[model samples]
Target: MDETEELIALCARALVAQMGDVPGVEMALTRNGVLGLTGAPSPDFNRLTLGAGPQAEDFLISSVGRARARGLPLVVVMSPQAQAALAPVAAGLGLTVAGTSPLMVLRPETPVTPSRPVKITRALGVELVAIAGDLEAAAFDEPRDAIARYFDVCLTETAGVEAWIAWDGDLPISAVTVTPTGDTAGISLMATPPEHQRKGWGRALLTQVMADYRSRGVARFHLGSTEAGLRLYESVGFVTVANLSAWLLPAEGALPGRDRGGPS
Candidate 1:
């Protein structure tokens, strides 16, 4: 694979690891795709990542079958090229197009310096996990329990993932996660409560995380960006490298919710 392809695959693996350890969740790599099964209400957690190739269509078909068998909503992550190749097959399977997200990367020649002195602390213990989960849920307008599950999974593990919360005078305002894959670190779950937006807390949190990872000898960073935060990430030296599309298959008698905002 080329550098871009390698980076994308690395990011995908990182995400899989982040989703690991959740109760009733399982992940497997097959010739078809990278499959994640979460027999829960969160559709975002149940995903399939498809690569571009002649087998892409077959992979999509099998992935859909796997999701259907589990009776969960299916989110398919595919490169733009792969999406094009499998569009007909996806459509034939009744998969609805769920918007596209840009995959961005940052390769810094020097360690990133924080824009301001933000009191960022590593999230430890169950209490802090609940706080971080609340911050995330408030920021994304999601259910607290759902966001808490993510924190519960990541914080319980030492390898592959790390979580941090930005505090303003002991008041947690933002949260971030870094998952390392090979030489690249994937950033996700970045969220600042609505009351804290436009005040630079998000940037400060991200800067600190970048600096922390850089100190660990990680130079490359990858994230999936939404339109709202694209400019903020660009200000910090991130650039769009590729696009990722998600095709959704909702469970019977259920409608898929709109994609959540912020970096994934």
Candidate 2:
């Protein structure tokens, strides 16, 4: 793969590793220019697919149709370029497209060093914590041991499997995971408890991860975000680079049977 494609692939794999525990999510290859989105995605989280020829509009319409037919949301996650080419059809479908989380890529040229140094020491007993049991009961609300096991498989099976629950003392507040892809690093499984809002813990965990990536010579760091989380990401130096969106059709929509797809 060329540089761009390679970067996309690295990002995709990192995503897969992060969400691998979410039973509904999976990674599937896409046609040139497109990729699949997997992992318990809402109908709004359809595949970050590529485009076809001049008929790209028609193709998107068809993909949207099939997703809604399965009682699944047809979410199209795409880069800025892909989103631009397919906007006409996307807007017609009541799609909501937003920027990927602003990511501060640690390029040698990326300016503005962090205000303070990050303290990343050991993985054992430390200021970090983790809960490995099935999170569906609380986090996902689906409540099934099997569902929780999904994450276990992903975390244990992968090479870069580290989950963190940052704490000021004994109480748990924020959480984040770091995964690697090629020469870059990916951040996944980020969460902060409701009571922990506005506390700097979330940014602290994220900054710590980014610093680690910098030390490793990672060319880029990647993230996806919702409108609510945009400001938080911006503070760390991420930009408006790509977007993923999809249409929400009623049952028996156009093309029936297209699986929830996009990413790799």
Candidate 3:
């Protein structure tokens, strides 16, 4: 694949590793894109990230239908590369633009480090993994149960994915996840709770993680950045590759067949 396509594929692979086996989740690989449904209340977990290809429209429509069938909201993540080909199709399917983020790739350089280093460690055991999930949920204002469930599966079983957390003595301060695909690695779900936002923990954890991964020979890194995170990422040498537009399909009020992590 070419450079842009390779970055997109890294995103797809990282997403699949995190969501593939989260109990009530379902995933489908289209001709060039990926569809994921977590059956969670949050739209963040239900997505269709399109790729640049002839079948992009078909994959989008079918993915929307799948979400509607389950009575859930769906978010379609489209990069500028795919928007020319799929935006009209998404509009025809009744998806409305919800938000936009930047898709970024790290430049070839040492990651930026915080002036004062903080203790950061890989989330190795079940308890630490669960703590990582808790921090993520708080950071993003997502449902705790659903986020926790995804991280539990991701930390316990996903081979390519790994999580790290910054700590203050015995308490956790920030968390992030990384998934390596060949020389490229995808950074995701970086979190620092509201109370801890101003501290340098996030920068510390991010730089340390990237540097450690670099030591392991991972030459490139990519991530989708919220407006709040753009500066932080750019400070560490990540350049915007594409503008990612998010389109949302409101829920139809149909209940999911099974709600994972909730009373059955």
Candidate 4:
């Protein structure tokens, strides 16, 4: 695999590891794919990651069966190359295209100063889990309870995940998570509520996280970005490495709530 492909794989593995222990979630690793099963009623927790190879289609088919048997929605994450190779196969299976995001990576570079005064601090213990849910609810405009369920399962002590929140005075405005896998640190869930946009909170939060990770000897970082977040990430020296497509099997009856689908 090339540099971009390698980074994508590393990020995918880190995500799976972070979410692997959700109470009812089961993760199965195949030779060319990884499947996450959230045995609960919510479809938002289930995920699949496709690796590069001809077995991509077969792996996806098997994942669909597993998800269906448990009555959960299947969200498939695949790189541009893998998506191209599986397009015809996915078409035949009648899967719906949910959304797509650009995968970005940042190698060690000169640090950029934040335009605003923002203080970022790590969230420890249960505070970390609560902050994660709260940030997602505020950023996505969803119910806090629904988002909390995800954090409750995914943010344990052994999950190898760390969360940080950006504060303006005593109020928290932005949040992000960093997970280390091999030599690469995957940065994800960078979020700021609609009311706080354009104030440099996102940039400040990311700059702090990047600096902290770099201090720990981590030189590489990866994340998938939405259209609204693309500019902020680019401002911090992140470049597009690949485009990732998420194919969703919409659940019955309007689907519980809106899922950001890809990484934030």
RMSD of each: 4.7, 6.0, 2.7, 4.5
Worst 10 residues of 4 by lDDT: 255-264
The superposed Cα distance between candidate 2 and the true structure at residue 143, in angstroms, equals 6.4
- Tens-place lDDT digits, model 4, residues 10-34: 7667768767665555677765578
Q: Using Cα atoms with residue i matched to residue i, what is each candidate's TM-score against the true structure?
A: 0.89, 0.64, 0.91, 0.87
lDDT tens digits, residue span 1-264, model 1:
755566667766875777776666667775435777666556776788877766677767877876676567888888877887888889888788998888888886644778988898887788887888888788888777766555566775564777899999979999988888666788988889999999999999999888877888788898988889899999998988888887898876232353221122
RMSD to native, candidate 1: 4.7
* Backbone clashes counted, model 2: 24
Question: Which should have the higher TM-score, number 1 or number 3?
Answer: 3
In terms of lDDT, model 1 sits at: 0.77
Measured by TM-score, the strongest candidate is 3
Error of 2 at 145 (Å): 6.8
The per-residue C-alpha lDDT of model 1 at residue 167 equals 94
Per-residue CA lDDT of candidate 3, range 10-39, in tens?
Answer: 677777888886787889986567888887
Which scores better on lDDT, 2 or 3? 3
* Candidate 3 RMSD to the correct structure: 2.7
CA lDDT of each prediction against the hidden true structure: 0.77, 0.51, 0.80, 0.73
Better of 1 and 2 by lDDT: 1
Q: Could you tell me which 10 consecutive residues in candidate 3 have the lowest summed lDDT?
A: 255-264
1 or 2: which has the higher TM-score?
A: 1
- Candidate 1 clash total? 0
The numbered model that scores best in lDDT is 3
